[model samples]
Target: MSNCKKISLSQILLLVLDIILILGVITTVIVYYNTFFKGSGNLNGLNKFIMFALLTVGITCIFFIILELRKIVLTLIKGNPFVWLNVKALKRISLECFIIASCYIVNFIVNFGENKYKFIYLDSKGIHTDTEPIIFILAGVFIAILANVFKTAIEYKEENDFTI
Candidate 1:
């Protein structure tokens, strides 16, 4: 597994996604410190804790989404992606997206009346915007619909197989 070998497109994509996930974890820690400690002095203890908790939840949800995507990609590699397992994985991915969206919504609500621009953070490179809850919510809806579509495909496939 450690040796370099011929890899398919799916395998390469999966490897890239894994690398991104690893970097995301590391970046989250740095962002956590910068946002709470170096951002502003007006942030109270409760605000800090809420932000930390929400960040953790959002990250965990993202982690699970990647895991589910890996499963689906493995199925794709096997040339049988339209299976019950993929459907379940898609369902989980959809739920995780919803959870992430909810966490962002909570953060937005918590910082609604704050004086600072809580939604935007400035770093060395440039100003980075937080995740938009509506985007993820819409993604959740789209993934859920896809899961159902896969379910129907499986049903039709099974029926055809039985008929044959």
Candidate 2:
């Protein structure tokens, strides 16, 4: 569509992402406060280590994802969405997703014996599941494949430019 429309859509998306990232940071700070300052020694060393690691990696990935999305949106605003740099950004975002997914799996395995899997919640009220990491893994693979498609498209566009 028009440049204005493209920027408007991306700007909306960027706003939403910014809000989510802010909320995530706030939640993470609250969690850390409750887990350490007010934990009353309920959490062990290993659990604390894992929690910190998970949050660090998760937040880092989120930051990188937002950066990559900003790059893509900027390209869209410039009327050039299929560029080599966008491909690299997409690839990096995909790798970040995989890394986050692996962290979740590691956390699950580390807590398997303690019956306290962070990804799978089991409470007296009911059984709640957090399969977000798995979904992210799948999304990562899909995005990686999409990046390849973008690479091919870029190559084709270059060839067309040369022909013209």
Candidate 3:
């Protein structure tokens, strides 16, 4: 317990951003389910099942992300080691990045086909095409890296504190 009472403004900003990201995730899930799955007469049974599965997974991920964010916030409040908090957060963020990137790749492949074969398959009847998964992927990756950096910084700080 070093007498370090100074809180970095950047950490405050990161906490705020994490809160916003959690809210955005929730909104995205709601919009996705409502727009894609509600009263859609186009999809057959199998397709409907697949869509529901995807939605369920997406919602579950959002819940996990929120949980990780909460853990990080708790760590900050308790003034615990950042590395411990970041390990959990970074793992979630990395998984989210991979999931979002894979989803985009799958969507692209399913819709357009491989090797320039112009096969235009609709994702669903009423689903909006405006949500680009690439953005999510990139954001997830960025946050993951940020978390790792925080972890590293804390490790360095601990080392310096011990050297004195």
Candidate 4:
């Protein structure tokens, strides 16, 4: 095999992901502070508590997905992209995505049929029809499929290793 010491696209993506994760955390903090601590809102104590819980869950899932991607990137940089560890990481990332999506769905359910903004934006017209959670759900399924593909690749690699 050719020497794999050079930087690759995966490395660049990893750097970008790291930056995004850092920025996301900072933004989450700032938004939470401004929304709750600023004391200029109509949300009650229970609503604020539920929203915070959901946000925490969603952020935790995102953090885990980023961490798994970092592990996968490191393995790819080492020229061992077909390792079982990567398969596990992909599976974990998929699960985290699904969890984040579920959290959004629950948020929607909690805010359903309410005319006032509670847990989620509730306008006189209708509930907040945010499709972000649906997108994340689809992304999770796609990642799960990708994980299966990686698992197959790992099997092929192991078989090739055993061959002459």
Candidate 5:
């Protein structure tokens, strides 16, 4: 744990955010311009629009998640990881995760019932699998629990301070 302080995580997260932003722009363009994607499992017409919307929302949520992570990392750097701001940030991140999960799950469902290709691949590649919804949903639940733990920690710290 002591060795971990030598590295700057905030900068790493910032770099990650920058990458996500760049990739997000490229992905948004690709998703919006269905013509660019000429292959099976590609979206079109109303389906394209729906996919574009979902992808936009998912990217936006991820951007916000990184922003909140930056905030939390800043707090950690300040040697105060149990602050209320972090709790709020964690709660926000959890909510964003849930929203992203919902979007992917919706996309999954929308594509599942259709005879045509969906925004997310439900088949092919010699296997059938979709992990986004599960991953985000689990992240949401775990982060929410962590937020509660932080809240409780803050309450305990406050109580300890007052006892003196």
Candidate 6:
């Protein structure tokens, strides 16, 4: 096998994605702090619910961002070509997608009707109850498939390397 370790286009893409993900996490944190911690009056019942949702989604995104950073670090340290096609990487991607979906669901719940306060604190609770579970289930399914794909890709690459 050739010993060349030239950086590939895909590595560049992954690096860029990782940077963007980190920046996104930072932005989310800033927003959360500004909204929740800075002298904002106590979020009332419905506002509290919405704040919790945002916090949950933000935390999830931060976790995924950290995972992506780990993957990037591992790829650089190991000097591997297909590092991003690994189980850990897939898990991170799945988690990121799930966080995004959850954010959309929360946004929908918070803005569902003409009266913004109608769904607060159990009033019209059904309005906020439909989509999150389904989205979470779908995210779980995607994560499983992503894991399998990663394993298969890694195995295929190994087989090809052996053949050559």
Clashing pairs in 1: none
lDDT of 4 at 42: 71
Report the lDDT of model 6 for residue 123.
43
Residue 102 in model 3: lDDT: 65
Write the candidate numbers in order of decreasing TM-score. 4, 2, 1, 5, 3, 6
Model 2 gets an lDDT of 0.84
TM-score each candidate.
Answer: 0.80, 0.82, 0.61, 0.83, 0.75, 0.51
161 Cα displacement, candidate 1 (Å): 1.5
Better of 1 and 4 by TM-score: 4
Q: Score each candidate by Cα lDDT.
A: 0.86, 0.84, 0.67, 0.85, 0.81, 0.67
> Which candidate ranks first by lDDT, i.e. highest?
1
Clashing pairs in 6: none
Candidate 3, pairs of clashing residues: none
Better of 2 and 5 by lDDT: 2
Off by over 4 Å in 4: 1-7, 115-129
What local lDDT does model 5 show for residue 16? Answer: 73
lDDT of 4 by residue, 1-164 (tens): 99867777988989998998999889988978887788638767788888888988998898888889999999988878888999899899889989998888888777878843244576688786567787898999999999999999988888998995
* lDDT tens per residue, model 6, 108-150: 6676783443323444444343455466659756776967776
Tens-digit per-residue lDDT, 1-164, candidate 5: 46564657766766777787778778767755654365526556888778777878987898899778878877876778899999999999999999999998778777885654333554456555457788899999999999999999999999999999
RMSD in Å for candidate 3, one decimal?
Answer: 7.6
Once model 3 is optimally superposed onto the true structure by TM-score, how far is the C-alpha of residue 61 displaced, in angstroms?
1.0
- How far is 149's C-alpha from truth in model 4 (Å)? 0.8
lDDT for residue 107 in candidate 6, whole number 0-100: 64
Task: Sort the predicted structures by lDDT, highest score first.
Answer: 1, 4, 2, 5, 3, 6
lDDT of 1 by residue, 98-162 (tens): 99999878877887877433457888999877657878999999999999999999999999999
Model 4 reaches what TM-score against the true structure? 0.83
